[model samples]
Target chain A: MSPFLRATLTIAAKDLRSEFRTKEAFNASLSFSVVILVLFSFAFDPTSEQMQAISGGLLWLVFSFASALSLNRSFARELQNDCLDALVSAPIPVAAIFLGKALANYFLLILVEITALAVFALFYDTHFAAQLWPILLVIALGTWGMTVIGTTFSALTVNLRMREVMLPTLVYPMLVPALMAAMTLTTDLMNGIPLGGDNLLWLRVLTGFDFIYTLLAMVFIDIVVVG
Target chain B: MRDRIMYVLATLSAALLTWNLYKIFMILPDEKNQGAIYRIVYMHVPSIFTGFTGFFVALAASALYLITKDLKYDAFAAAVTEVSLAFASIVLATGMIWGRIIWGIWWAWDARLTTMLVCWLIYFGYVMLRRAIDEPTQRARLSAVVSVFGCVDIMIVYKSIEWWRTQHPAPVLSVRDGGGMGPGMESPIYWNWLAFMCLASILVMVRMRQESISREIDSLRRMAHAY
Candidate 1:
């Protein structure tokens, strides 16, 4: 592997390894998702038809918040022992640090999302057996879009005092379009609606947003991370 | 001299606002479907245009700051961004009021409004990000990156919302290209747009001066410490 890829993967692996050891972020996010899911279920009874109609929205909400929760830890880990400063002074490319974090957050969010989806399905009594593939496609695109911006903002806010509040404020707005597209696709799939021209347009938007933002974030991350 | 220009611009803004209000209330014709209440467009649409201008300039300033590493560009970006948010608030307030009067609802998930709200949140996030950090240089650098992304995000929000509106039909009114405005309404829109632009520009200039002064203070403090 090239040096850039090796550096990126090394950072990602380090994060993943540490994450597995403590599981602090993953556990916090999963429980946070559960609480939000449960709270939402209470607000709107699951037995109602309205609940079914908005299940896609509810699921995405959980995913978005959960992802935020996980991403807040992306830089918190580096802040320990002044590791981020060390990494910055090291020979590793800045883009590699960003890509590695994005990748790590992406994987972590997918785990949280999958868990949340299962719980959402159970709570809402909605089945996605037939629509699983399309749902996964939406999740992948949506999560990638979210992680790209979220990880970058996470890094940006690491030095701040109210990082917990800062992360969602920054990430959530950019994630709206992705969330809308993902929610719409998931809803249509759940309703057994085919991917018509209209649906495909949203899919195109999701894909386009993911591609554009990830590239933009990669190019700009060095600026955010470095002085 | 700089203060004198601001005074002149302030006077111009006041005169233009008074004239635009007169034109909107007395001269402009009512919409065929919605009477009287449609006049809110004079406020809402012009503010939206000005906000767009503010945001676009912010994007350019941000890019320039990043490239040139000049505090002036950073100050300009921050100043205009705040001005843009102020205009965005006007858009939202006017839009909600109009929606309430015409559609019998204060809020609707219409595409244009949703996109505006998203854009507002992103810039609000930018401001929060600025407040969170203590280091002036780092804050400016990260903020520039965010402003650039914000500009790009607004475009995506526009396109996504436009597409989303197709699936869920929204009230469409366009003053541009003679699509919605009729007769006397056209000229007032032009004048109001120009007026709002003047007002927004003046606000940006005043705010930019404040930012520059603050930056100078910070640098002066650092120099004092060095002594």
Candidate 2:
């Protein structure tokens, strides 16, 4: 295998192994998401038609916050054992480190999201039809964009005091467009709109955003890591 | 002395501002639709221009800092970003008031407002990023990368608004085609924009000087402790 791929997978495997051993990050994010969803359920009249109308938005909100939790711990874990400095000294590309962390975080986020979906379905009488695939597609692309951007910022802020609070404050606002696109697309899909025309236009926007931001993050990762 | 030069610039800025305000209120004609309230445009448009100007200045300073490895340029960039954020907050507040008068709502997720908010938030993140990192080199380099990315993000935010075709008013002030403003309205708006730009420049310079002196004091204290 090429050095880049080898290094990327190595770092990713290390993170996965460690996370599997402790389950600290994953458990926290998953439980926090459930608590948020429950709060949303109580805060709004779950029986109101308005709840159904806004379920997609509420789902995205849960995912956004939960993903933030995972993103923070993704890098913070590396710092806990002085592993980040060791990783930096490795003879591998820094972009690989970013990619590896992002991939792992993406996997964990998907797991959390799926579990949240199951809970959302049970708590609310929302219907899901053949539109599941497109909704999932939007979620995948949206999460990719979110994770890439979030990983970069998390790495940038990892060494700071109060990073746990600062990371979300810094990352969430930048994720607005992705979140907006995801919510809009998911809402339409839930309403059973055909996945064409304006809906496709939104999907294309999300796709373009993912491509551009990922590339941007890759190019700038060196500045973030080395600095 | 540097203080004298700054004071002269400040006096010029104040004089130009006074003249511009007089022209906007006394000389400019009332709009057919907006009546006297349209006058808010004088402040709104100029503030937005100053905000963009401050961002570009930050971008240039960031680039210079990265190229030269100079802490002074980094301080300059950060200072400009801070002032720009202040200007953006004013723009947002004034825009909301104007929107309330015209659109009958306190907030609308229109293209211009939405994009402006995103742009503001990104720089807000930029400022917080600087505050989070303590090492000067790390702070300078990371902030440089951020400022550069932020400049590009601003463009994306602006273009997304146009592409999505949301309810924000179309750009009423573009250099292309001289912004299509009537001569009656154009002159005062142009003058006010110039005055605001000058005011923004003065604020950035003062802030930059303070940052440089603070850094010097910090370094001297560190040296004293080492002895």
Candidate 3:
């Protein structure tokens, strides 16, 4: 592998190992999502037909909150013992640091999202046995879209005061378009609506959002880190 | 000289604004379908135009700040974004009034409206982000990057919302789509936009001046070890 790719993968692996040992963020995000999902059931009859149609929106909403929960701390971990200063001074490109964190967050979020979705399904009793692959594809695109924005903004707000508040405020607004596309696709697929028609456009939109933002974030990460 | 220019621009904006209101309320004929309620479009379109222009300028200024490592561009971006929020608020309010009457609702989650709203939220957070960081270079660098993220999100939001619905009228100005309105009908909106643009420019300059002075004070305080 090229040095850039190697550095990126190394950073990703390091984050994964540290996070796996603690699972602090993982447990927090998952339990928060479960609480939110359970709380939502009280607000509406999850067994009703209406819930089946709108559960896609609800599921992603839970995941968005879950995303905010974990991303806020993604960089805070490096702040301990001035690890961030050391990392920035490292020989690796800052973009690698960013991509590494983003990739790690992507993997963590997808795990959280799948778990959350299963919880949502169990609560709402919705099924998508026939469209599993496409649902996973949409989840990847949509989660990647949010992951790019959330990861970048996490770094942006990591040093700011009240960053726990600032991260969500900064991250959620950008997530709207992505969340909307994700919700729409998930709902349609869960309803047995196939892709490759009007749905094709939404798929393109979600993918395009992921592609452009990832590229933009990589190009701009150095500026954010002040490297 | 600067004060003179400010004086001239402010007066011109006030005079043109009065004239545009006069033209909209008295000179222009009522719409065939909606009557006088449609007159709200005059304010709605111009406010959004000025706001969007400010936002676009912010994007440019932010990019320049990134490339040059200059704090002035950061100040300019901050000024433009705050001024743009004022205009965006006007657009939302006027749009609400217009939609209530013409579309029989106070708000519609159409493409244009959704983008305008989401754009406003993102930039508002940009301003907040500026407040949370105190170091000069760090603030400038981070907020500029966030501004780029905001601009990119605007396009994504617009595109994603387009997939759902698009109820806002097509571009009616002669500059766009070859003029959706009749020849004479479009001129007032353009006139109003020019007026508002001048007004927004004044706000931006004043804010920039404040920013520079405040930054100077911040550095002096740091030199004195204030905190």
Candidate 4:
């Protein structure tokens, strides 16, 4: 395998193994997402129509927050053991490190999203008959975009003086476009809208955003880490 | 000595701003359709223009700092970022108020508003990034990168909002159409723009001087401690 792919996978496997051992980040993210879902359930009127009306937004909200929460902690572990310094000093490419962290974050986000969707379906009577695969694809692309940018910001902020508060402050605003696109797609899928027209337009927008931002992160990650 | 000069410039800028405000409210002709709320255009237009000016100044200063490795240029960039953030805040506030009067709603996710908000948030993150980092070189380099990224993100925000659906009308002041504003309105708007540019320049100059003085004081203190 190429150095980039090997480095990315190695770091990703390390994070996944470490997370599996402690389970702190994953558990916290999952629990927080559930709590957010419960709160949304209580806040909105319990009518099926109202529940369906907001399910997409609620899912994206939970996923966004939960992803931030997980990404913030992902670096904390590395920092605690001077692992980041070691990684920085190593011969591996910095973009691989960023990609590895992002992939780990993507995995965590997918888990949180799946759990949230399950809860949403149970409570809101949401049906996913034909558009399920397409919706999942959108979520995958959107989440990858969010995690790429989120991991970069989180890594930068984690080394700062006010790591806890500054990470989300830096991450949330930049995530708006991805969140908006994800919500739009999710809503379209839930509403059973045809995927070929305006929905495709939004999907294309989401894909375009993912492409641009991911490329940006790749180009800049080395500079950010080393600097 | 520099303080005195800054004070004099600030006073002159303030005076000019007051005169321009008077011209906008008392002397300018009312729009045929927009009526009195159109008066907000004076504040709104100037604030937006000044905000953009501040953003470009920040970008230029950041680039200069990176090239020169000069602390003075970093201070200049930070000053520009601060003033730009202030102008962006004013633009957002005035825009919202204007939207309330014109659109019958307090807030709308239109192209202009969304892009401006995103732009403001990016710089806000930039400022926070600087605050969180304690090392001078790291802070300067990181924030410079962030500022450049912010400029690119601003362009993306502007383009995405335009290409996608949004409530905001197309540009009212495009050069392609021989300028969109009528002759009567253009004169006062131009005057207001000049006034705001002066004001923004004065603010940034004052801020840069203050930061430089503070840095000098800090270095002196460090020397005393070492001795």
Q: Chain A TM-score for each candidate, in the given order?
A: 0.96, 0.96, 0.98, 0.95
User: What value does the lDDT take at residue B5 in candidate 3?
Assistant: 84
**TM-score: model 4 vs. ground truth:** 0.92
lDDT of 2 at A5: 88
Fnat of candidate 2, please? 0.72
For A1-227, candidate 1 gives per-residue lDDT tens digits of: 99999999998998898898999999999999999988986786778878767877888888887887788889888888999999888899999988988888888889988988888888778878887888888899999998998888888888888888888888888888888888988888887776777899889889988999988988888888886
Which is the winner by DockQ between candidate 2 and candidate 4?
A: 2
Candidate 3 wrong stretches, greater than 4 Å? B157-164, B219-227
Instruction: Encode model 3's per-residue lDDT on A98-196: one tens digit a residue.
Output: 999988999999999889888877877888888999999999999998888988988888888888888888888887777877898999999988887
Which has the greatest TM-score? Answer: 3
lDDT score for residue B32 of model 1: 89
Against the true structure, candidate 1 reaches a TM-score of: 0.93
lDDT of 4 by residue, A1-227 (tens): 89889999998998888888988888898888888877876786766577666667777888888887788876777786788899889888898888988887888789878877787678767876677898789789888878887787777776787888887776777777777778888887887875777777777777887888888788777767886
Tell me the DockQ of each model, to 2 decimals. Answer: 0.80, 0.68, 0.78, 0.61
Cα-based lDDT for every prediction: 0.84, 0.83, 0.86, 0.80
Q: What's the CA error at residue B167 for candidate 2, in Å?
A: 2.5
Q: Candidate 1 has which clashing residue pairs, if any?
A: none
Candidate 3, clashing residue pairs?
none
* Model 1: per-residue Cα lDDT over B107-142, one tens digit each: 888767787788999999999888887877888898
Alpha carbon lDDT of residue A14, candidate 2? 84
Residue B114 in candidate 4, Cα distance off native in Å? 3.2
The TM-score values for the models, in the order shown, are 0.93, 0.94, 0.95, 0.92
Candidate 2 runs further than 4 Å off: B174-180
lDDT of 2 by residue, A13-95 (tens): 88888888998878988899899988986798998878767877888999999988888877777776798898899888999
